[model samples]
Target: MDLELRHMRYVLVLAEELHFTRAAARLGLAQSALSAQLGRLERHLEVQLFERSPRSVTLTPAGEELVARAGRLLADADDIERQLRTLSRQPTAPRGLRIVAETIHPEVVNALAQRHPGMAVTLRHDTAEDGMAALAANTADVCHGWDLPSVPLRMRSGIAQATLVDEPMWAVLPEDHPLAGEEQISLAQLRTAAWVSPGPGTRRARHLLSVCQAAGFTPDIRYVVDDQEMVRTLLANGCCVDLAPPRHLPEQGCRAVRLVEDVRARLFYAWRRDSVPGWLAREILEESRDAFVAGLVRRGPLYARLVEQEPARFGPLLDIDPAGWPAARIPVPALVSTA
Candidate 1:
């Protein structure tokens, strides 16, 4: 009682072939079945769609009209089916893990790659504020940076954080500076030294200012540079001194002297509460912590001495057990003495 797509196909095929046996062969049906199906279609529509003779098959005027409409309908149906198949065959875009950090460690990234081979990973360096904003906006999955308690509660509402490491803030001075030779220097001793710090209004800059004020002298900030290399250049040229953690101190041009006051900076791994799965977040945090400690272990004598002499200060890193680290991957020499 109702028309179907098969009826349209049958009508068009028979019309094109003009022979029941030939049309049925092309349609992969028995000739009798094709004829019976056509009869059913005509009866349903209450009209003959084909004229037949012993010697030939021909389209009736009704058949001609029906075939004209059926051809268009069948063409549209085929096109839709083709489009659907093409869409089905196309692969969906791969899920990506985007990370923002102040410093990207290759070992951490490589560990992530090994753990999630199918996942696409990307890392970029950005300020802590921007990194937090990216996590809130769903543009980033994770962020590695200094923990700032001064961040407003609203900005941190849906963010989860884990402490990665607490590194002591060292005085990065020119290798030949007057106080560079001191095993430990007090902040008061550097009161007259010109300072190179991050740009004004940044969280780091604000923290630096507060730290200096607490240390009993306002630092005469002579140079404001955000790039680490440029900051190193300024220090290397003996233009200014700056505070940095062991990992951030320049290897070639600066001497990192321990602060006598034991000032420390806590590095954090942060992410939106809902951005990553719980297991993945834990894995990333663990891997980041391990990589950071392993890097310190491989950072030559200074950090080795810190780890060796001040195991209490670095208890968390020691808990992870650097002795378990693969010797081939990260060559860590015995921490016998300070450089």
Candidate 2:
């Protein structure tokens, strides 16, 4: 029983659609040609592949088995074709790069867009776990997040990664919140405040749990949302507090404080080492991630300016103290609530 990739593909697509005409449309083949191909395949294999009735087509036992077997063969053939095409210099064809980022970073976006004009990048807003999932499925080429050193993302699959930077996670509070007056509040000290955080299983939520538990209390939670903008607005209303990478905060409208020495979170990028290319596109992407991180570091003063505006968040800007800057910014003295 010798079957070609085209035959196998026809079987799989036919089985999936259970309709000769629709499957042909999906495969970009004429309906009559598709039917002829199926007839040839069935005759060659000496198997009646489908039980055709007026309204529906059902797979015969033999048809089901052949379709299943054909799926694997078709997949292998497709893989071989993709590998060959990419390995060869196909004119004007873009090498695909699937990158999963925790959230989008504008600098990284801009930097990469300029260098990799021909590269195809599929972006997914994913958690670190989502990134690991993408890596395991061989869907994504690279994943980026804060470069946490100690947190080993050991998935029981074919994923490996490295740290790009060590930075602090910030406690985001509403501009009008009572605690925003102080330069910073300890994670433990914020126990009575209503919190907006991820579910307990998440890394951010887990860090908050560990920190509060360490500080001798469980945190008071008000909301658990995944969206960053939602996190900012909820905190900005002075109703609840949350945590995130300080650098990820809006340049205005939110107050971000470094987790008081004890509570912190880090991020990293994971990829299947073998899937990444040893080509110019990969190198350029790596460089872009590096430059974006550097630019974030250098732009601490701009962040401070946001803090000082006190239109909300960190009120009444303090003078620029680049002392330990980027590493640490002096808390702008909280704006006094005139009300």
Candidate 3:
């Protein structure tokens, strides 16, 4: 006989509630019955899933893995059933779209909602790992992340991608530093400065290392931080020399100078290749791309203002490479967007 969904549900509820009595009540079953169901599941799977004491029950490592996988399975099952019921009522078009990004452009959200009033759009903030996980589990139709994976460790195979931006590198320095006095810095001069970075595995790391190689010397890294805001604070306080987009320059205390060469990073939008964007989803993707570019343009004024402060040393305008963008761009309608 095949394993039924009841066993999965039993495990999920137990994992959620933690206590046997509470989980049993939530599942509308007796404590003894729930316990028996869990035990049967454990035996069938040939794994110990729980570590229970009198006061509490916690999932073992194996159990934690099972619960995460099972939770996604349950959610997908529910969505499929709900979609079928919705289809029975009206088969005209898709009712909603789902998207997840690290930081969303507000204009993109507004334009998508206004342009397709019939389509409901849901947004979630995600990390690179979270976005990758969402795509793999089919929880999200698409995601944007900094790094593209070579193996199918998490994400499914055959996901198509579109690059959106080549965020140019800038050298963040203290106001008092001697190099800060220069109008245009040479690569040799910049490499000698201490570096602040996110560490070696990240795209930023790759860019930072590449910057040093081009400059003819490796840098002495003084600090590491993942948060961009924190990086600015560290640079301002003299923790380490910072490198990032010109926009990431600390507003008040520190300054940023655009590197001379192609010292930059890329951001991309990726989706399952064989999958098609459902209703207004395709339009939403296009709107997002436009908003991101427009935001960069809007920041040009900011760069200009920084130029006044330092005069000759202020950074250059970061440019987007069209070739790095999606191979198959979404077709936008002739309608003028309100965003």
Show model 1 residue runs off by greater than 4 Å: 1-94, 148-155, 320-339
lDDT of each: 0.77, 0.64, 0.65
Q: Give the per-residue lDDT of model 2 (tens digit) for 53-140.
A: 8799899999988888877887788899899988686444246778888756666665555666776667887777677777777877
Those runs of model 3 whose alpha carbons end farther than 4 Å from true positions after fitting are 1-96, 113-120, 147-156, 181-183, 273-282, 302-339
- Per-model clash counts, in order, read 0, 4, 0
> Sorted on lDDT, highest at the top, how do the candidates line up?
1, 3, 2
Q: Which RMSD does model 2 reach against the true structure?
A: 21.5
- Listed per candidate, the RMSD to the true structure in angstroms reads 15.8, 21.5, 22.4
The digit string of per-residue lDDT tens for model 3 on 202-238 reads 6556666666776788878777778777887888876
- Candidate 2, superposed: residue stretches over 4 Å from native: 1-94, 106-114, 146-152, 155-158, 251-253, 278-286, 289-299, 302-339
Q: What TM-score would candidate 2 get against the native?
A: 0.55
* Of 1 and 3, the candidate ranking higher by lDDT: 1
Q: Compared to the true structure, candidate 1 yields what TM-score?
A: 0.64
Q: Number of the top candidate by TM-score?
A: 1
Write the residue-wise lDDT of candidate 1 on 68-144 in tens digits.
89889989999999999998975443367899997788888898877678889899999777887888788998888
Q: Tell me each candidate's TM-score.
A: 0.64, 0.55, 0.52
Model 1 steric clash pairs: none
